[model samples]
Structure formats: structure tokens, C-alpha cells
Target: MPTVTWSRLNEDRRAAVVAAAEAEFAAHGFSQGSLNVIARRAGVAKGSLFQYFADKRDLYAHITDVGSQRVRCYMEDQIRVLDPTRPFFAFLTDLLDVWVAYFAEHPRERSLHAAASFEVDTDTRVSVRAVIHRHYLEVLRPLVRDARGRGDLRPDADTDALLSLLLMILPHLALAPYVRGMDPVLGLDELSPDQPALVVRRYVAVLAAAFAPQPLTTATPGGAQSHG
Candidate 1:
């Protein structure tokens, strides 16, 4: 958490400090991130950083918190314009497109998120992971409920389990292009402009198949009727 002195700083100064910290941690993970470099980049004295935060860990935590908020805000903005009446799979494809756009444009924030997700300290990692998971679930729960209600998804499906699979795979879809070795088959080095769209479409196809409504069959004189 930041001190009152941090609040007293001008908005531009605060923004500079946050930007510097994000860049530093994005370039080097928490363990190797340098306060001196951050101070130099932000044009503030190293001691002034201590006045703003208690320690390196505190600053790191605050920066990650800021990044998470930015991610949520970006998603909220996308949600406002997206069509709510679209079918579940169509809506989901658009939702994933938003993820790809956000991560692609904000590489620094993505790196900060990755750092927190893979934090070395067990306590920090768990705490950050909880917040990330909560945000993801909050965004997804409604979509899953709506899909089930609309009979686009199986009513018997476990919401939590379905969300867990989405949490595991969807976010990584955005990273495939940016991260080295993450897209071995896609060969992002020479990727076409439409390659990302192709990736998302294929992934959504698999999800649609996996989550399709279960068939309801009734007995007939000579056959079973499928009400799938």
C-alpha cells in the first residue's frame, strides 16, 4: 500500500513512478527488479520511493494491483460495446478477441501480470493468484449461466469446472503470439496478419464442441429421436 505522501504527489509524478516500476518489473522479474533503476527512470530520489511505499515488496504488490485494475477497466470498456444478445460461442469469440487486443497492446501490463502469476514467493503468488482468479470468475460466471439458460450449453455441466478450463486456456490464447516458444505450431515469427483470428477460431470451435448441449432422445417405433 502507498503512503499519504504518495497521494500528495502530482498525478504526472505518480504516473511516472508507476510506469517506471511496471517497465522495470516487466523487463526483470520481482527478484531482480531494481529500485535504483526505477528511481532513475521516474526522476525521483531512491529514498523518496521508501516514503511512497514501505519496501520493495510493497511497491511490487502495489504495481501489480494497478495492473490488475487496468486489465479489468479495459475489459469493462469492451463489455460496454459488445452485443449481449449474441449466441454464447459468438460472444465468447469476441470476448477472447478483446483479450488478444488488450494483451497485444499493453505488453508491459501483461509482463507484470505474468511476473505476479509466476512469483517466487509462495505467499505473494497465492495472494495474487486468488485476485486474478476472482476477477476471471466474476467476468465468466454470468456468461456460463446465460449459455446454460439459453440451452446452448449442457445444463448438467459443472459451472466451476467449465470456468476452470476457460481460466486455464483462454488467457494463454492471447500470449501465444507474444511469447517465444508458446506458439510452436503457429510459427508466429512469420505469422500472417490473420493468424491470430485463425487461432481464436480454432480454439472456439473446440470449446463449442466440448460445451454443446447434450442430446435428448425419445423412443420411437423404429428409431430413437434426437432432440439435441
Candidate 2:
């Protein structure tokens, strides 16, 4: 067999390392995973891991970056195919569809992310956590702002508040299956990848209705005392 040089390793090996690392992290979380085991699983030496990454945190960050980029690309691709004139709820539905696809296609990455969320390392946790948090904010902030500009959203709607609600709601919906009996009606865990889109679509419709701009109606003369 020809010798494998430091730079001669194919992309397959690199992908293997990432995949193995994701599984390791998902199984053990950040603080508990063993680099030695990871290296062995990746068919590399413990020292070779350092050749590819400075440390465990670096590897974890790289995983986060890769996963985030994949999700961003999926969202962008979906958005590009959408009609810009469509209502904002259509865009939200597309967004959820992309997420459902991602979770189904990359379940291990999702598990890794779920594990990372509870990490105890202040610095590493905060850094990686920020990447995921910022990803959602970066996408939603502009979308919400544009919707408001187009009169698709309520005039008094708080973009930040809406972003926060979406950030909280999407993940909960996405991860409900993994949450252990939290959503019996959804039973996300039991549903296959093909099934999530429909469930998520209905969920987004409810949110869209709640956030949709409503026509102002004149108050009744004897309407209950207004707070403002």
C-alpha cells in the first residue's frame, strides 16, 4: 500500500473524522468525550488529531461551523426557490421545511447540537452556543424587518421579540421527540423525516395566524376600559 502522507489523506478520511467526532460528542457531550477514542475511531493517532485541530474545543467549533453552514445553505436554497411576493408565512413554512429536512438527513449532527446545549464549560459553551444562537438571529432579524417594511407584519410588532419567540419555538418543535414525552400530540420522535414537514407546516400556520397583521377595528363605546 502506498504511504499516506500528512496531506495525502483523501476527503473521505476527513469526513470520517468529522462524522466520528459528531457521534462521539453526541454520545458523551463536550466534557466527557475521549479524544483518544475519537482518534482511534477516525483511524488516526491521538497526535494526528492535534495535527488537524488544536484541541477538543477547536474540533467542536469546527463541527458547529460545518453544521451551521449546512443549515444556512439549506435555508438559502429553499428561500431562493420561493416567490418573493409570497406572504411571510410562506417563507416561514419553507424555513421549517428546510429544518425538518436537515434534522432528518443529519440526525447525528442534531444529536451533537442537542448535547452541546447543556455543556458546562463557560468559555467553550458560550462560544459554540453563540454560533447557533447567532445563526437564528442573523436569519430572522432581516426577515422580520423586511416583513414589517412590506406591511406583512404588525406595525407595533417587536422584531427582537418575534425573533426570540421563533428561536425558542422552532427548536422546541424540532426537538420535541427527543424531549421525552413532552409533546404527545406531536410525537416527533416517532415521526419519520417525511412526516415532520406536514406537522411543522401546521405549527407554522398557527404561529403565522397569531403574528399576522390584523385590521384595526373601532372600539365599542362601552368596550371594557382600555389599559392605554
Candidate 3:
């Protein structure tokens, strides 16, 4: 959390500090990010950063918290406008699209997110996961429950289990395109521009099958449809 001194800073100064810290942390993970560089970029003395945050870790945590909140709010806003009655798989794809769009519009946040995944300390990582899990339980639980009621999921499906599955893979769906080595077959360098979309469609199809009441006659792009 920022100290009272941070709130006293003018809006522009606050923005500059956050922007500089975001860029630094995005380029280098927390372990390697430099407060000196952040202060320099923000046009504040290095000593003054301590006035805003207790320490380097505090600054990093603050940046991550802000970035995560922005993503959650953006997702909620997009989900609010979506038609809840859309076909289950199509609806999931649209939600994923919202994530892709958010990252596209906020590349710095995206990079910071990636860096945080690799480098956050155990406590911070646990805290981040808890926040995400709460959001999933709040926003996604109702959707899956409704899907089951509509027969989109198997009669015996466990809503919490399905939600957990989605939660596990959701980060991959959002970040795979931006990260190297995310695809097993493609390894580090084979992620062509189109391959990312193809991978996403395949994931959607697999998820649809995992929870569907029956085998799908038609699957999303890059997925094989069942034929009898």
C-alpha cells in the first residue's frame, strides 16, 4: 500500500511514478527491477521513492495490484455487455477475446503480468492467486451454474471442478500468444501470428468437450468435429 505521502503528490507526479515503475518492472522482473531507474524516469530523487513506498518490494506489489485490478474491472465491463445466452463454447471464446483485447491495449501491464509470474516471491504469488480465485468464484461461478442448468454441461458435471479447470488454463489462454515456449510442439520459436489463434480455438474446443453433455458435432476452428 502507498503511504500518505504518496497521496499528497500531485496527480501527474503519481502517474509518472507508476508509469516509470510499470515500465521498469515489465522490462525486468522484480528481482532485477531497479528503483534508481524508476526514480530517474519519474524525475524524482531515489530517496523520495521511499516516501511513497516502504521499500522496493512494496512498490512492486503496488504496481501488480493496480495492474490486476485494472484487468479485473475491464473484464467485468466487457462481460456485462455480452449476451449471456450465446452458445457455451462461443461465449467462452468471447471471454477469451476480451482478455486478448485487454492485453493488446495495455502492453505494459501485460508484460508486467508476465514478469510477475516468473519472479514474484512466494507470498506475493500466493496473494495474487487468491485475488484471482476470488474473482473467478464471484463472476464465473454463476455462469457455469447457469450453463449446467441449460444442459450445456453434462448432467453429472461438477460446477466447481469445471470452474477450477478453467481457472487453471485461463492464464495460458490469455498469455500464450505473448510468451515463447508456451506451445509444446512449437517449442520456443514456432509461434506464427496465426498459430496463436489456432491454439486458442483448439483450447476452447477441448474445454467444450470436457464439460459438454455429449460429443460436439462441430468444434471450433483447429479442432476436429466428431462424425458418425
Name the better of 1 and 2 by TM-score.
1
C-alpha lDDT (0 to 100) for residue 116 of candidate 1: 66
Give the C-alpha lDDT of model 3.
Answer: 0.75
Over 4 Å off, model 3: 127-138, 186-189, 215-228
Give per-residue CA lDDT, model 2, range 1-228, as digits (tens): 112342467889888887777778888886677888888898888888777776667777777777777777777677777754568887778777677666656777667667667677787787677778878787778778888888888777766777888887767655664556646676565766566776777777776666778756555568844332
What is the lDDT, from 0 to 100, of the residue 110 in candidate 2?
A: 68
Pairs that collide in candidate 3 are none
Writing each residue's lDDT as its tens digit, candidate 3 over 1-228 gives: 789999899999999998898888889876688888999999999999999988766776677777777777878888777776677778888787777667767787678667766765776565555555666678788888888888888998777777887887677655666776775663323666566556657778888777777754766578967643
Q: What C-alpha lDDT do the candidate models reach, one value each?
A: 0.79, 0.72, 0.75
Native-vs-model 2 lDDT? 0.72
Residue 50 displacement in candidate 2 (angstroms): 3.4
Best by lDDT: 1
lDDT of 1: 0.79
Pick the TM-score winner: 1
The alpha-carbon deviation from the true structure for residue 184 of candidate 3, after best TM-score superposition, in angstroms, is: 2.6
